[model samples]
Target chain A: MESKVNKYSKQFILFNSIFIFCWLVISIFPFLWTFWGSFKVKADFFSRADWWYTVSGVNTLIETGGRSTLEAYINSWIEGEFWRAARNTAIVTFSVVTISLFLGTLGAYALSRSTYKYAFWILIAALVFRAMPHITLVSGYLFPFFQLKIWGILPTTIIVLVAINQPFTLWLLYSFFKTVPKELDESALIDGASYFQAFRHIIMPVMWPGVITAGLFSLMLAYNDFTVTALLLNQQNYTMVPKINAFLGTVEHGGNYMWAVASVVSATAPLFMIVMFFQRQLISGLTTGAVKG
Target chain B: MPHKTFFWFFFPSGLAMILFIGLPIFSSFFQSLHIETEQILIEVETCDPFGCEMEVQVDQEATGLLREESPLGRFNGFGTYLDRNHLAFDDLGAGWETKTSIRNFISIVLNLPFYKSLLFTLTFCFSVTPVVVCLGFVVALSVNALAKSIKGPVIFGTILPMIVTPLIGSLVLFWMIDAQGILGATLQKILDDPNLSLKASRNLTWITLIIYGIWHNTPFAFVVFYAALQTVPQEPVEAAIIDGASRFQRVRYIVLPHVYPVATFIALICLMDNFRVFEPIIGFSAEGVAQSLSWMIYKDLRNETLMLFGSAGATSMLTILGVAILLTPVLIRTWKEFRTDR
Candidate 1:
């Protein structure tokens, strides 16, 4: 019996080693390749038959004619207009996150704690709404927006994003709010605090976990959105996803690959920071709907 | 709580959904039924100075009447939905009827934009789900067996592919598939074909996109399965081991059953998500080689002069119908669970 256990453990170790080794290589290789390629001159990136040119020969930065990747970043920031796209992304992410959190907290609080059975039905409706492909929603928005002359504007897309994000926000926050004991805040109303005030002073601090998770989801949604913003926003209002796509088209057609890689690298810098710090929250936020709720 | 409290609390999100989701769904349906047009008239201007010009102009009164009839568009109920850009039922029937063989018939059908995109979308959805789920399960098991101290970094690495923005993730990998890029160069050398290019072939493009789909989605499934693994009851595993079961037998009888529900959950979500594959084709600039249902809609709306809202609206309806078909089983199952629980 002991011999069998030992033999199985050895097999398991061997299997796991192979899986992890393969996974790590596939996960890290592309980003490392892109990161390396981003610093190489346009000629090497496009013309050279060898991809090892960056490491083998003197790697020249495509932007600013420098020898370092820093100039590539600067060009992405300035010439590629990623800074503008970043600023637009920040505004959209911040607005969508804050507004979704604020509204989601209120709505979820009511939906979870209310004795009214209709609140449950409202959540089911939100779930259905959430399940629909968002392109359908964008298609719906086009004509009304064009008729109203509100199309191709940042605020228009922001509001649409907030709306698309509502169901997810409410669903995640509802589960989060359910975890908090109702008695904790229900007693505050007996002490003369209104429901809103009870929610404000009593429940707000405890629900931070859910709020943060929902905010992370919101931030990721707004940050990574390509479909709606790509369709709805005009050239002047393009966000990071669409902006990088534009660079991909323009540069790939023009035979300049460096700018596209540089822009992608710059666009993803903030996400790397977010993942490093908030990996736990991001995972929890993503799986909350699946596993818990 | 007062009854009015529900209203006050839910009003904001409720209004947002009404304005955006609820209204748009209704509007999309209505838009699918309508086809907008300009009321045009030819005006021949005769100038006294011996020059005459003829110009086609939009008839303002008639245009206003058209807008008044339906601000979204003129109500051509179901016409756009059946047009050559959409269902094209007659054209499809003719193509199928005229073909000499199955391969010729398929080629004819695939030439239709809507059918071509549907072919790719369904192919992507059906292929990616099972592959990602199985890969995810293996990774989950492997991660679960690792030393506790090393697990954190391993998980972080696993999640990195998923964490990158979808467009950028596809682009980062799309660069490598370039003819001059590393993998492309390696493949060229390994195969001894100097002229081999991923971009130059449709079949290779589809495979690369499928591989990208699996690469991007596996981590999410892995994370979910890993979380589910923590809750797996250990007694059955131990009992099976003591009963002279092999490791494979134990996994088959104990561990597999434990994560079965999560595997199903991930499969359902993956099906729904993969049905809307859009960004990769755009990111790779492979629109010429591949198109998705979502990309098809984007194409219609991005037309140079006319936005083609009517065509986009019809395609959106079809996409919504596709999603509904995918979602029905899950919805029915959930409804059953709710009924039984109550």
Candidate 2:
């Protein structure tokens, strides 16, 4: 029995270590692979033999007298208009974050503070909207926006994005606000502050973590979104996600895909920074989003 | 809260939602009833004995007027929905009335664009979600068993998939799985067949997309379940061990049940996310192989000259309805939980 137990335990440990190791590699390697592949010339990266030469790209650089890491980055930036897309993405993300946070907070605070059934139903509506894909929402926006002649503009897309983000933001913020004591805000109201003032002073400061989390979520939803931005934004207003997608379809450098790899890497760099800085918040925010909705 | 306070607080978001979301729901339904008309210019030629004369004739000028006057054309209620790209009542009828054999009829119906996309959508959701959930639970449990010192790096690596934008994440995987890429080459080598390419066939593409889905989403489940695992009780496992429960049996009885709710949570999120599986199809260039409803909407809406808004509207409505159908059980359960809490 002791020998059998030892054998089983050893097998279990070995299995788990292998599983975790594989999981880590599967999770991390594709990204590092693509990031590394971005630097190589088209010929080198697609070469069948000595693929390590692809990542190194030094031999190819010497042979062709061109195409290095900096070359790919430069080509992707200039040819892809990386700055334009990045600027548009930044403008849209920040606006969506600020606007969604403002509205989502007030609406969520209202729902959390109220004792009415309407709050419950309203929240359910938000949840329902949240569950539907943004493409569905964009469908609804098309005709009306066209009639109003506002299609494919930054503000139009921003408003639509905020509206779509509002549902999830409201859900997250509602739950977050529920954790703050009702008495805290009410006490501020009773002392001297008006309702808005109380919210601005007491409620916002009290639920700072939730606010940040909700803000991060709004930024992410706007940033990572492909369907709405892809459809709504005109050529000049393309965001990073859609721009990267457009790169996939167009022929470049004999279909090298290095520009695509470079675009993917550039688009992903900020996300890496975000995950590193806000991993805990992101994890908790995602959990709250999952469990609450 | 005071009524005025509530009003002020909820007003802006409520207005935004109503204008953008609430109105759009009704607008989508309304738009679905109406199709847009193209300004088709027809040149009619009349040949005389002396010479030939050409005169420009405008057809469907009323439609052109209507199209110009209103963003929505004539309301043909339920017409777009039942058409070939949607419910395909005509195709169904054609299949039923024409085909003599059952197998052939079934094939005809499945070949309809609407039904093919619906099939792929359903297949994607079903195949990806459950497997990802199980794999995620395994990873979560494994990581939960690891020492504290080593777990953080493992977790950081794991979250990278979930962290990276879905489009970029899937693109990375797509590149790796290209026939000439490292993983694809290695896979071909392992099979001892140079022509063993994943991108050639529909089945292979579907499998590759599903694998990518699992790889991308499993970490989310892992994190959720890993977090849940910390709250698992120590006493029950000890009692199970004392009762001579085997390691597997102990895990089966205690650990699995402890994580059941979290697994269900992951499953719900997975199912919903997978239902609208649009990004991968585009990233993989798998539109020929896999066409999802959301992608259908994108394709329709992206018709540069003809927006196909009515068709898109109808598909969007159906997609939302599908989401509602999938979410009904979860909603009911949550409502029950809320009532119990109340």
Which candidate should be chosen as best, given TM-score against the real structure? 2
lDDT, candidate 1, residue B57? 73
User: How much lDDT does candidate 1 score?
Assistant: 0.83
Off by over 4 Å in 1: A1-8, A57-69, A190-192, A252-256, B38-73
Q: What is the per-residue lDDT of model 1 for residues A1-293, given as tens digits with 9 covering 90 to 100? A: 33232244666788788879899899988887777667767656654466666554344643445664555567777877778888899898899888888888999899888866687678778877888888888888988898899999899988899999999899898888888998888889888899899988999878988888888888888999998988898888899888887776665444335777887877777887888788888778777777743
Cα-based lDDT at residue A101, candidate 1 = 84
Q: Can you give the lDDT of residue A179 in candidate 2?
A: 82
lDDT of each: 0.83, 0.83
Q: List clashing residue pairs in candidate 1.
A: none
Q: What is candidate 2's CA lDDT for residue A68? A: 60
Candidate 1, residues B1-342: lDDT per residue as tens digits? Answer: 688988999899899999999898888887778776766575756566778777667677877776676666667888987778888888889988899999998898888889999999999999999999999998988888787788888888888888787789998887788777778888898999988887789999999999999999999899898888888787777777789888778778888988887888899989998998988887676899899999988888788866777888889989989998988777776666656756
Error of 2 at A205 (Å): 2.2
